[model samples]
Target: MFLFEKAVTGSRKYWIWIVCLFAVIGAGFLAYLRQLQEGLGITGLSRDVTWGLYISQFTFLVGVAASAVMVVLPYYLHDFKAFAKVTILGEFLAISAVTMCALFIFVDMGQPTRVLNVLLHPTPNSMMFWDMLSLGGYLMLNAVIALTTLHAEQKGIAPPRWLKPIILLSIPWAISIHTVTAFLYAGLPGRSFWLTAIMAPRFLASAFASGPALLILLCMAIGRLTKSSGLREPVQKLAVIVTYAMILNVFFVLMELFTAFYSQIPEHMEHFHYLFAGLDGRTALVPWMWTSAILAVASLALLIPPGTRKNPKVLAAACGMVFLSLWIDKGLGLIVGGFVPSPLGAVTEYAPTLPEAAIALAIWAIGILMITVFYKIALAVRESLA
Candidate 1:
């Protein structure tokens, strides 16, 4: 019943997937070695664009990790039966996502060995320290709750009564993780794009949408692969949650636009102009930004109609569209767009180098591998009970 032993006993297809992930991870490791030897010059980061793809990904994955609470709240606090079957899966997904967030931060630090300085020389005034604390604490909370719950289930015993309090604590902790992350950008003095009062709410709304959409897809895939029957109702319920969250996310985006353009402040307007239409002939991100907007609208159209949202195939596609749209909006667009015309009023463009991309791929591969192993163990336990 050991987790690793159970994980190694997965079917042929699972092992094949693991092998492919390892291959990508290996290549990335080699690329990281080169980066360590040569320093951060291997990345697309420049004096103007200091935070590149790594920070962007870290920001995105933090939202993904915090999304676990949507399921946890209804299942544990409200005692909702619809979320019963997949609560463990959500927690395990959070674990993998938080792991990715931590790894992305580690790799972004050119001197990986000096990461201890964040802890050793604690800066109480810095938001980065608070971010580290929130993510690390959330990771521990999820891991402990998930493993204990699974272990109790395998033994046909209820989880300890005392654990309920800790579960409740995680609800606010989940909100705090992304809120603190937004504060990291929002509090910056010169970053006009992220200085909005709504940044934290926007982050939470988008996280709720993207995180649950991903969970729905994963649930569907697991049910198909495992030949299970109970996921249909849960997946349908999740789709509704995703729809509402996506609506709020889109609303937040529009609110941001209205405030920026209506106010007509050159500092605030420039960031929006640069992201959507390009500034001074720097049109690199305009295409991607528009594509994200179009996809968001299309996905909303599909999600709003109860009939289409209830159809499994349609739901899946809409979930995918929403996920991709948010990834482009928050993942690629948000981080890079904030620095479009830099703080000093100079236009500079940044694109990830091959090695940087490889490293990012490796981190993602590692996260997927972790999820696979965790789910394998959970599935084996469930099958044994059945």
Candidate 2:
């Protein structure tokens, strides 16, 4: 009861942030309600561009949540003292991020209420069910593990000897959530572009890069605005990890393009054509496509220079660009682009309507708000313990 109460009564600033966050979310809620009343017709989704921004965000965030394991495995399993101070925060961030991912999907669905239909009447053959199961399981695992670890720390007791296995289990489970998410795209028999074996590896690489980039940016924000010492060494180490992951992400994308063009598969080439060339100027996603490329190159340039990576200002700029680049590349481009010139050879485009955008904005605001409130509680808890 004490712990529960403590969690609720956060600082005044925390409540202020919460109110602002909810104001944005409430606006989005009104927008989502409009969508629910009207139907998916309110958004830009047609038969061709079925999965739009919401689904794309769900995919990207799953990877972010999974990457929390990178911090956890090192600090907890391997006993890396460098990460000892910041790993708990990473765990909490993961929780908030995953919650947002779930909400985004809920809002995207045609029948938000019927979501239980997935469980009430399980589909043994559908990949969607497996995805729901994995995501739910992973969220529970992260929450339980993180809270138990924090509880142990507060009491100055070592984590339970047996909980180590659960932690170990979470590592692969983390990989599975994103893999299942990729499979959600890749498994569609008609979409030749996403049907490749390389999709899972590509997902892993991009997730690793984008996840750490966000963590680094978060650390920078903490250092600048607050009295926190910030995560210096661990942030640097994670940046190195991001660098390697970025290279792999670029390589996998190149390999995929090469394989498609080399194979001379007309079905495969069609998707790329829609993305790059634009089908009859009707499906012109050209601006987004080019912007993604430029951002990717710029991010790599900023990250590769040791001087730039270490400097707070430069690192923050690079991290921001990298984060946006991944959102455009994976969240918007990859998902929507794949469905263009869809199986029927008809070109369709997607642009979120005001309501859709509002709902999405609300969901994002809610996530930031949750992080702020939780962090306030965490800070107060730490000070009390000390």
Candidate 3:
């Protein structure tokens, strides 16, 4: 209830932001209602490329939710006090990201009831089942851990002893969510583009990078918006984490490309070709893939140099590049790329219809709204303690 107090009371600018989010949400809701009435036919989905923007966002956000561990592990396990200021930010991010992930799944399903069916009929062997279980469990874990830790802060006392175990469990639980999502892709025998053993590792590496990068940007924003102090050290430390993870993610991508072209398998090489150079006459993804490629390289340049990365402005730009680069590659291109040059070897390109884009935008705005309210509550608690 007090949390709601903090969230509900804010400056004029904050109210403006919330109102803007509401506008987007309202428009998106209208689009979704039409979708529910008309079925998926209103979207760009076809028999050839069934999953589009929604599933890609679902996949990318699973990684973002998992990346919270980058902050949690060091702070709790290693006693890295520099992260003390921003650890809650990471946890709140996981909560919001997971919420968005679930919403993306719901929208992608076309019918809300389909989600219940997954629960109503349990299939232990199914990756989708495990994915759902992992996501739901992670969401609860973060929500509890965040609220408990914040309450403990408010009282100027340590979190209860029992929370120790839950905190520890959440670290690995975070990793599991992304791995399971990767398995959802890698497990499909029909999607050759996602069949590689490296998918899980790639997902984890990118999660570590992109997730923390977003955290850095958000902490930067929160510091400005709330007039908070001591965020710089943690943000810089996170930059180093992003640096390493970005390297690994790019390496994993290169390895896939190497295997594809080196093996001279048309099925494999064709997917890469379709992504980078366009296969036959279809080139919808070509420009976006190239943009991701450029951003990946450009971000590496900014982050690898200590002077450039240590500078606050450059670091923000670099983090922005890191987030957007992976968002394009993994969030947008990855899923769409897999389905293209369909199992039958036809070059089919998929694009999101306007309503599809609107609905996706609404989902993103909803996530942003969650983050805004969550952070407002958190900042209020901190200010009160101060």
Q: Estimate each model's TM-score.
A: 0.99, 0.95, 0.99
Assess the local accuracy of residue 52 in candidate 3 as a C-alpha lDDT between 0 and 100: 94
Instruction: State the lDDT of candidate 3 residue by residue for 80-120, as single tens digits.
Output: 99999888989999999999999999998867766798989
Better of 1 and 2 by lDDT: 1
For candidate 2, the C-alpha RMSD (Å) to the true structure equals 1.8
Per-candidate local distance difference test: 0.93, 0.83, 0.93
Q: Clash pairs of candidate 1?
A: none
Check candidate 3 and list the clashing pairs.
none
Candidate 1, superposed: residue stretches over 4 Å from native: none
Worst 10 residues of 3 by lDDT: 1-10
Clashes of 2: 0
Candidate 2 residue pairs in clash (backbone atoms < 3 Å): none
Query: Positional deviation of 269 in candidate 1, in angstroms?
Result: 1.1
Return the lDDT, model 3, position 351: 92
After TM-score superposition, the amount by which residue 63's alpha carbon in candidate 3 deviates from its true location, in angstroms, is: 0.7
Q: Model 3 — TM-score against the truth? A: 0.99
